[model samples]
Target chain A: MSVDAATVRRIAHLARIAVADHEIEHLRGEINNMLAFVEQLNEVNVDGVEPTASVEDMKLKMRDDVVSDGNYAKRVLANAPATDDGFFQVPKVVE
Target chain B: MNAPVRNPKLLKGDKHDWQVVIGMEIHAQVTSNAKLFSGASTEFGGEPNSHVSLVDAAMPGMLPVINKKCVEQAVKTGLGLKAKINKKSVFDRKNYFYPDLPQGYQISQFKHPVVGEGIVTVDMQDGSSFEVGIERLHLEQDAGKSLHDQHPSMSYVDLNRSGVALMEIVSKPDLRSAEEAKAYVTKLRTILRYLGTCDGDMEKGNLRADVNVSVRKPGDPLGTRCEIKNVNSIRFIGQAIEVEARRQIDILEDGGKIDQETRLFDAAKGETRSMRSKEEAHDYRYFPDPDLLPLEFDDAFIAKLKADLPELPDEKKARFVKDFGLSPYDAGVLIAERETAAFFEEVASGRDPKAAANFMINEFFGRLNKEDKTIEQSPISAEQARHDRRSDRRWHDLRQDRQRPLRNRLGRGWRPARGGREAWHEAGDRHRRHRKGRRRYHREEPGQG
Candidate 1:
């Protein structure tokens, strides 16, 4: 949609992005371009046409309900920002 | 539609043909020991830069070494999706600039994906079934996560997600409503979970979707759609589609225009805002990596995969409905999550199926959710496992901590409290008599006893 300058600023604030005032003009173009592309779908006769999500008609295969997990204590702990003897270290809960 | 779609049902508040044309691109984390291109551990929640290998970090001298396991996983995921598994697939660079992307471009599959043409039929809570089309399932490496919450001054980057194998499952737009979109994503996640290919945890960022949405009149053409990027949860996807569709309809009917760009979903306000313009595949200038060769698989291997294929969710759901005499809807719910479905079978088989299904769905799941635990963490037992967790844990340790102890001793045959009152009284009497005998023996020989 033709979102206004103020609306663009409001949206940027909502999305928590740092957008400059000059960037607002750029965003307007970018957003306009995107909408134009999606609008192309309007040209196709989709009255009875169903929008497809996937291309096939099958279900997902499954394993025997099992509990498979990692046990590499060292491996799991290897990338910890901070570690104790065998655990990830966090700030102590108690004073 | 908030727009001028002349649907009688919508007038009556049905929005039925509020037909949500939902399509999804589900990014599922592939289960593997290493990343797609490097030997870095494919794990979740690691410190920044730790899980990153030379290739992931885009080292000057580094070369891409395709992880065969990741490739196999992509093929396996394809097989599970009933898609055409392409043995000959090439990796291309999805050119994009993100702070989290160490390589500045994602190593993704373009024209040649490992899996092609799969379909998911989401049986809604209602009796109707909606078929969502699967376009292609490709292999790619995940970018790092940007942790914005921890600090206002600095955005921390966690590369633990970097190089992790991901199967980007793209779908054809077949959804007719926001509910259908949610259901489609839910079903897709269930399938992925069933295959044991992904953990399918959206909150943990293991699985996510980039939602493409639009609106059109029933007989008129499709409207210019907007792409809502990287929505992490199904509920949010549904919300985003609804908001976006309404916005498009409003704009079109109001003589305004819909902008085609990557938008962000504000779950708090239930709206989508523009993020950036969507880029074409050509914009990325996709080209095959010279460092890796196109993989080719033999027929024997494919046959092996087919033979080794486990009972999928549909089969299991149908079987649960048939063998266990559970309702189709109940079976679907039971089988929606893989571990829960397994727990249901272990509890249902050779026991009261109705009771088992009820407990698995109601009590077990309720408690687990209350405790904020996953089905993978559920402490429920499988009926077939002869020994308990101790023995299985030993086996896992012996297997070098790969296999897991897959059960808790919520042993079958524990009759419901209300139904087995007589049996409970009888057992109590017997236990009391045994205790009396023990007391007598202790009085006769206290120290010896």
Candidate 2:
């Protein structure tokens, strides 16, 4: 699949990334080249093969339902830009 | 009784009668000790951020491990609904942006859900029943809570609920009225409670629903549906569907088409307003997650879970009708809650089942409601009720003979049993004397003067 300028703009907007009007064409071309390189796999005739999420044929690992980790509120909120009373604070968002 | 020729809930429009179609998406928090993919506590009402693990906080290089209990719970719920449990299921990342979502994308099932289509038989208040088709059941992680009224310029974020496992059960558009929708939720909650998968506590937001409603002519094609999101109570769900359907009918009657969008139910104002238009809605690009492998299980695993299943509401109701010789309505009311059904069974054992049902439903339940207490909080236990039943029978026989008055039958200075009618009458007299706003039943001891 090839990417166009309009598609690039829409993608940028959906990702909440800002892009300049002139940079859309360059980004579009770069995306198209990457897609073309990945599209070479389409030439293979691999019908009836089950699509898999991981290359490794391994089962999903599971853990017992126990509370083994938590209660380090200080460390949890250490990287937050803002906090108040053990809670992360952000600009009001109501919808 | 004969089936009605038409549904009584059809709305009369200016030129024609309109029928409302509804579907529900219920999100029930899985009852587990830890979160779905992290080892963090899932207890409600903890200190903010105290339940957050590194994985839940989305720290760099933090990996997610599936919780075995959560998957088992989802399977148990699927079995309870008589749904198809897929041997293999995949979890996908639903891409979106929200302040409460620290991961920016929620891990959910999109194309391949864990449970497949099933049917829930919903019994209406009028003794009629309808089957609501289950589309699918998928597992997903819950987002953090955002409290908007916490501060003047900032909102407080609580991640205690983040990463909690939720089973999103979607139903087909088969509900024709608001009452059916309410009954459907009620029945689903009972089933989940029976399976012990979810607590079904709406007060703590453990269960919530998103209702999709549309209005169409009696025999026309389906109309555009507007989704009312995050309705917490069954009563509000009914009101929201009615209000949204009326709004659509009015618009269509005026030659204006309904705009499909997500709306919010303003319970205080009793109306639904648009939250976001269809054009501005988020396009959730879902894809399989690379961090986790596909969930695969064998038939033996499903068989083990199914064998451990408890008797569900429908089965219990049927048993009550056939074995206990109870009317369908009485059986339905008794088995609505697991505890109530157990209480009834305990009292009915080795006794007249019909009489026991009548006393429990008419007398015990009535008094419980008057005092605003549940079966667990009853002043009298089932054993006490059984003991009292004997004395009550004797009193009935004495009154039936008509040869002597009750006072004379119980000769002078001959005290009745502990919970006999005489003691109850004395307690009632005391209650009237001390009617100073006490809520409990005041009973005197057997030997007390």
Candidate 3:
């Protein structure tokens, strides 16, 4: 599938990234390149092979259900650019 | 079993006969100590951002690791519902933009869920039961809370709930009425509670549902469904379905079309309002996450989990009916919760099952309701019931011994009351005597008590 300027703009909007009109063509070409690379893999004949999501071929490691971490409100909120009363404040979102 | 005939209550409308079809998507928080992919605590009501971790906050270079217990809990719940457990399941990134969601995309299961089709049997209040088909149970990460009340121009984000594990159990559009929808959710919550997978506390937002409602003429093809999102209570689920169905019926009857969209139920107003139009909806570009491996387990693992499962509600109810000869309704009430079922077993064991049922339902439960307490909060103990049972056995023996002499003095039909005060006093005295004899016997026999 080829990516057009409109599709690139839509994707950028969906991703919440501000892309200028002049940069849409560049973004479209970059996305098309990635899509073309992904599409090439579809051309290979592998009817009998199982689809692989990870290369490790191993089970996902699981941790015990124990609460040994957390309770660091100060440290957790430290990375936020904006904060209020131990919370990460953001621009108002109304629904 | 075929789908239950559409509930007449849902079918009968003001102007014409209309049928309401409901499908539920219940989101139950998995009972886990930590978040789905992060080590942050999953405890509720934490101070804002207190329970968050680097992964929960969506910090750069953070990766998600699967919580094995949460997966096991999902599989256990699936088995309890008699659902097929997929040996392999994939996780996908559901791309969306929300301030509460720290990550631009939510890690969810789409196309390939951990659980496959299942069936939940819900018992109605009228001593009837119907099976609701489960579409699938997918694992997803919960977003954080956006506190809109704290500021005039900004919303405070609490990442404490972010990355928490949620089992999005989707049910087929098999429910016919608001009652059935409520019953279906009630049964599903009970099963989840029985499996210890979720607490099923809708008040705490641990369990919530997205109810899909539509109206149609009887025997007509299914109508367009408008989803009421995040209805948090069972009563509200029923009310929302009814209100939305009425709204649709009114629209159709007035020569208007019901738009397919997501709406929110106003509990205060007892109506549903449009939340988002279809034209402005998110695409949610779902794709397999490259960071995490597909979850796969063998038959041995499934078997082990199945073996470890406590006797589920349906099985316990069936045994109550078959072994204890309890009615299906009584059995259902008894087995609605694991604690209640265990308490029933303790009280009903080696006693008159029907009498035990009456005591539990009428006296025990009645007192509990009057006092506004749950079984977990009940002042009465199961050990007291055991003591009562022992006394009951002794009373039965004493009655048998006195039967001949009493028959000789009075008429043969004359007998003691089932739970008369006299019998209770006799049982108490007998218990005291028996205890004294046991103490004497222990004194006589060294080292035995």
Top DockQ prediction, candidate number: 2
**Candidates sorted by DockQ, best first:** 2, 3, 1
Q: Residue A70: error of model 3 in Å?
A: 2.3
Model 1 regions lying over 4 Å from their true place: A1-95, B1-19, B149-154, B277-282, B358-449
Which pairs clash in model 3? none
> What pairs collide in candidate 2?
none
Candidate 3 lDDT score at position B184 = 87
| Per-model lDDT | 0.64, 0.83, 0.80
- TM-score of the second chain, each candidate in turn, equals 0.78, 0.87, 0.85
Instruction: Give a tens-digit lDDT track for model 3, residues B155-188.
Output: 9998899999999999998988888888888889
Candidate 2 chain B worst ten-residue window by lDDT: B440-449
Q: What is the C-alpha RMSD of each candidate to the true structure, in Å?
A: 15.7, 6.7, 10.4
Per residue, candidate 2 scores C-alpha lDDT tens digits across B234-261 of 7788889999999999999999999888
Best prediction by lDDT: 2
Question: Candidate 1 chain B: minimum summed lDDT over ten consecutive residues — where?
Answer: B440-449
